[model samples]
Target: MRVTVNGESLELSESTTLLDYLIRRNLNPAVLVVEYNGKILHRDHWSQIQIGDGDTLEILSFVGGG
Candidate 1:
């Protein structure tokens, strides 16, 4: 299946969850915010939310300052 992440094309296995994809891509959830198809997904819900083909995902990571 194909999905778009941050405007970049991504291919994933069928029935892959958002969290699974993130892990597969080596993304750190502790520092990143995940949005699925325009809705912001809570950290606790990432594992349950399934990603579909043609879905749009946006990932944002927070930065710390001294």
Candidate 2:
């Protein structure tokens, strides 16, 4: 299946959880926020949320600055 991630296109497996995808990309859930298909998805639901075809995701990671 194909999905749009952070404005880019990617081909993923037929079935995979959101958490798995994040891990594959080395994204830390604790310091990042995922906008799944236009809605802000909670971290608690990442494991259960299935990433379907054409799904849009905006992964925003936080940075510490002083």
Candidate 3:
């Protein structure tokens, strides 16, 4: 399936979960928020949400500064 991440095109094989994708890309869910298809998805649901073709995701990471 094909999806867009932060405006970049990405191709993923069958049965890929949101959580799996994040981990694969070395993204830490603990410090980031995901906007799935224009809606903010709860972190608890990341593991269960299956990514579909043409899905758009905005991965925003939180940075700590003094």
Candidate 4:
């Protein structure tokens, strides 16, 4: 299956969840906000939300600096 991560195209196995995909791409979920198909996914819900074909994902990581 093919999916896009942060605007990059990637091929992954079927039934891949958002949380699994983030791990595979070395993305840290703790500090990042994940949006799937225009809807924001709660950190706790990533494990339950599966990424299907043609889904557009936007991952934004928070930076704390003052």
TM-scores for candidates 1 onward, in order: 0.86, 0.93, 0.93, 0.81
lDDT, candidate 4, 17-57, per-residue tens: 88988898798889999889989978899999988988889
lDDT of 4: 0.86
lDDT of 3 by residue, 3-31 (tens): 99999998888868999989999999999
Off by over 4 Å in 1: none
**Which sections of candidate 3 miss by over 4 Å?**
none
lDDT of 2 at 51: 97
**Which residue pairs does candidate 1 place in steric collision?**
none
In terms of lDDT, the best-performing candidate is 3
Q: Residue by residue across 1-66, what tens digits does model 1's lDDT show?
A: 899989999777687888988898898889999889999989999999988889999999999999
Instruction: Pick out the ten consecutive residues of candidate 2 with the lowest summed lDDT.
Output: 8-17
TM-score, prediction 4: 0.81
* lDDT comparison, 1 vs 4, better candidate: 1
lDDT of 2 by residue, 1-66 (tens): 999999999988677999999998888899999999999998999999999998999999999999
Residue-pair clashes per prediction, in order, are: 0, 0, 0, 0
Per-model lDDT:
0.90, 0.93, 0.94, 0.86
Error of 3 at 49 (Å): 0.4
